[model samples]
Target chain A: MQDPLGRLAAQIGSGMKLAVPVDYGGVPMALTRAIIAAGIDDLHLVCVPTGGMQVDMMIGAGLVKTIETSAVSLGEAGGAPQFNAAVRAGRVAMMDATCPAIHAGLLAAQKGVPFVPIRGLIETDVLANRLDWCVINNPMADDTGDDPIVLIPAIHPDAAIFHAPMADRFGNVWIGRRRELAAMAYSTKTTLVTVERMFDGDLMADEMTAAGTLPALYVTDVAVAARGAWPLGLWGEYDGDVAEQHRYAQAARTPEGFAAYMASDVRAGAA
Target chain B: MSTPTTAHEILIVSIARLLRGTRHVAVGAASPIPAAGAMLARALAETQDEPKLRLSILGSVAHNFFTNGSAELFDCAAQGRIDAFFLGGGQIDGSGNVNLVGVGDYPEGTVRWPGSFGSAFLYFQIPRVILFREEHTPRVMVEKVDFISAPGVSSEGIWRKGGPHALLTGKGLFGFDATRPGFHLQTLHPGHTLEDVTAATGFRFSHAHATPETPPPDAATLALIRGRIRDELHESYPDFAATLRTAPLPSPLKEPSS
Candidate 1:
């Protein structure tokens, strides 16, 4: 599919759980923009650990109903204005998870396990509040037996979507050292990707890149959206548009400005 | 040795001192000072031939070695590998409870701050979890946090290997006593007195009769911090690094949110 953006948009049914990449780079901004343009609503958006532009913009556009992840901030570029506003306004349901909790949950799903035990969330309100999560005795106990560990339930999203530096026609995408992308792809039912560029030769042909390559077998769809993760970096390929991010941060400060900033997407959807 | 100019530098060096013997020191996102401290510790270790310090600054492509994202950091901590970590909060209580969730109640927050990221997790896993906040007022160091993002101390039954080690702020450095179950004024920072600490701090604590002043960073240490550490911080914290070029302004120490 040469123009797979439309197909990718179609895959995201309303009320479905959609997993995206973490902060800054690796976010599929073009597809995110396309998804926004498509005006899909009631999305259960799962930011990998946290999300910046994509999550904020989506929430601002009233496309998402729930967000499951940790901190949602713009990192150094002023903080997530839109996300903070929505949370304070109680617009979306948020599952405040840590980076590991999200990863461990995804890993458990990938491994087909019911749950995974992690060494955290004992005394915090995060633990107290998460009635769904359980604290169990460490099965493999040392001399100090019955060590309590927090076990997070598996998180299998309906779809995994991200932007990578390169991908081949065969569906293999080179994620470089960002191996978490592989885990995300494996755990989810559908994996949709957009890439900056496509490699002519097979990505798995070389043993060096093979390890980092998420074989197309796992990837359900591919779209060649060059500079797809805009205002966010593509790892080694390109840097984030810092000025644009700063402008976005300023523009997204208020509800009116946020609406104005996202007017183009709304227009695109209507068109 | 020439005395360091700013209180921020003093706090950075003080934090680095706390990380002297640590093998791996990790600083989370939005923490410019702690990031500098970790980098400074690594740089200092290089000069002194100390045990190799693996400094990991979250969100930095150049500084961090994690190919699998911060999950690897958590994995390392779970295995008892990470020696030190830094955490801050919107509200930190007397018992070492940190509240990063928000100001008010849970499930229905009146004032929502950033949701707890890894504070709850790391505070329980990493042995040395230093609570750092530029603001040291009663508003931040509260009588009780509305929401506990990470509890400083847990019940006896819970398998906890880590909790609050110390509380570092703009005004002073307070050491946490698990036995005391509270923070004791260790040393007041330069330009601040015991009265200032007492007036500002919401939590009650004891101090020794002769509590000395917190030492300022010496010229060599300041030079390393300003020169090497400053350069190293650019990749992860460009905004913070840019601020380090000039001597930091003396803090009137405004409340974090207010």
Candidate 2:
């Protein structure tokens, strides 16, 4: 099998839909940086619910053409500077969504359904804006006269990219309760994961760990990159680096500062 | 030894009061005050030996109960499991509409704050949604939002179990009526008058002939807040909890009526 970069180059390309975990920290930071380094452009990035430093860095690198998600910020680290700047500059297209809307869309894809009905969206402008989403009457309502609800279309992305704690040689990844990663992996065509380390034994050997493992069938390729989800947390492993996040939030305020930060912080470590 | 309560402390306690009987309260990411308030309520309930109050703080390892993160939270809310949730916006209107998308028209906007994550879903599904915005100004509370991320009320025939219950600003508190579908001035914060609330508020609201000052947290409440709540809040909101620790003592102007 080819290396991670080779696999990525073969799978990912311009105009493809890429999905990643939200900033609750399961992000594949190193692989995202590599995508930026590769200078991939016009990509449609879907941050499951939201994104953080990874979204901002890729946006700063001019790799993202459009984004579909609910919010992107460092949260408590003073918000997302680069993303705010990009939006202010009107550089990227946006698909504004709420948390459940994204989840419903992914669930629809996972179930191989055309769409799924969700609650609590009909009154919001989100319903008004999304041409792809439709509202249908609930046929099963007891009142039965009319019960309207929103239907979120399935989101079948081109790729599901993320970082995890570890992966066995068989490609089973132990996600340890971040089940959204599994949804993303199952709903996409190609799944590329960067890992903190390789599991010496079969992750699925034990029933307890197997409950958390995403089987190799869904994962197209696994690349081992120690500290892959750096500056972001790796559940059951390490905490997010608050100091680096603070520094990145501060430095990413301006284009010049962001460039310098990328050179000193991102590029140096990425190499 | 006596300790003075800061405005933030008062705010936290006030929010906790709104959450008195809630079984499950979920705090969204980037919300320090709401998160602290939920934890305070949890701590106070524990102190009273009340039935356990489960608080699911988004993105926190220690406090969060959901294994599936946002998905589980959404599912719980939809299933009527979440009792209360919190929401904020760049612009909130008289009718309880919130704008977190941006300031100007859609497709193109002037200012862009973070997009709405689950506010609409939770606002519709959760029975109680406390709208909290620290900056209570015309700019923040607008007459009409440029884009409605999640609406405050829904038309008939739409399934909605929840909507805005109350709106808490730094200066005052207002109760929302989903039926009448407007806000009513409830209680002004100490040191802030009705005129201050009106001047700062972008939308119109009705009020009683004489609005009373919102009661400050009692001594017992303050003790629980400063001691247990502050300590637990550090896990999810370390910096905000730090601010609570270093917060200056309450000024003499608004000293509790002794």
Candidate 3:
């Protein structure tokens, strides 16, 4: 059989806009590595709200051209060096956003709407930078007063990519409570997933799993890449390798250090 | 006699004091101090039989109750379900304006901090937004922020349910008044003088005739902090929790000199 993971990575060509989830949500680190190895470039990366090591590694590898997200940090591991360095060097374009604004934009796309009205960001510099976002008086307000709110336009990415705990042979991925992944898949043109393992039975057949399952209808492809979210934990499956994360953070501080670290046991062993 | 307190313990106690009467308090990522404070507040409430405090520490499996991912947090804030939250910034001014983005020009700033996460929306929706930053330096507590990730006060007629409630730093605490749109120095932490705060702060703030020292946590509170709170905090913040466990016990109490 053809390597579906490699095939899935091939579908994501250079310059495509890709949407990904936050660190706590399932991050497809293995797929990210595959994309990096494939030498994908000029990718417009949209973090669902925020990102962590997955984003840092991509940025360090010089894969991202434009990044749209609220924040990017390694949490306890401290700042994301490559992201900070790239931003400082003006190597990548940044669309600084707030968490809800990103979600609101995705929600608008999911709903197939032009824009969605959201509270806050009326007078913030975050609003000022994004000329795409607009503010208007609440049309629903009657006679009482003029209430103003921000409106975020829909964010339709070329593809959505993430890892999950399980995906059945039918391509139904069980995202459990991480509904933001569903929103991303719904809003994007294509949805590609990597999972730790494949569920034997049909995910939709069971009531408990069905509610949490993203039906094969929305998912375009599924690739079984066991421990796909390695170094970044899945909710119930495993804990993140904090020591490795810290090692990466320290090594990635310098370009040479990053290269050496990537070539060392960590990246090579993962491959 | 009052027990001696560490700087972190003092900040935690201060945060818990501000969290009083709040039903639900949410601590965002990278906020070990605030999370510890919330846990302490919950413990206090349970012991006192006050209304049950709903604490949500983001990134904690055992603590967080949000099932719908990051969106639900904002949605809950929009509906006014979250009562209190903690927001720290790269720069904060007297008017409560917070700048999480870097200094200098937009897009290509000289320095780049992490982008504003949920501050833009949560600052407006959550009722009690505590501005907590450990470093109380002049650069961080600026006269005016280069960029306002979230404004302290919105324009007239704009719908805003929340704004800055208090500003806590390593040195002291400042209470924010939305009406006056300014900050007032509340109390200085132990070992920190008003002069020390004035020297470190860039923004001007008003203060009463005699500023009192922030009260040290009692023996019971200290025990709870070292024991139960540290263990609870370990789930998400292992490094911080470990430090709390190994932290040397404070020296015996000393008389306060006027």
TM-score for chain A, candidates 1 onward in order: 0.94, 0.95, 0.96
RMSD, every candidate, angstroms:
5.7, 4.4, 4.7
* Model 3: CA > 4 A from native: A265-270, B1-3, B246-258
Look at candidate 2 and tell me the lDDT of residue A255: 93
- Ranked by lDDT, the better of candidates 1 and 2 is 2
- A113-204 per-residue lDDT for model 3 (tens digits): 99999998988999998988899989988767889888999999999999999999888999999999999999987999999999999999
Give the clashing pairs for model 2.
A99-B117
- Among these predictions, the greatest TM-score belongs to 3
> Candidate 1 has which clashing residue pairs, if any?
none
Per-residue alpha-carbon lDDT of model 2 for A1-271, expressed as tens digits? 6556545645678888999898764788878777776667998888897888999998888888988988888876866888888877878887878888899899999999999998887867887888888988887888747888888999999998988889999999988888999999889979998888899999989999999899999999898888878888787788889899988998998899999988786565556
What lDDT does each candidate get? 0.83, 0.85, 0.90
Q: Provide the lDDT at B44 for model 3.
A: 93
Tell me the interface RMSD of every candidate, in Å: 1.8, 1.5, 1.0
Candidate 3 residue lDDT tens string, B71-94: 999998998999999999999998
Per-candidate TM equals 0.93, 0.94, 0.95
Error of 2 at A235 (Å): 2.1
Give residue B196's error in model 2 in angstroms: 1.0
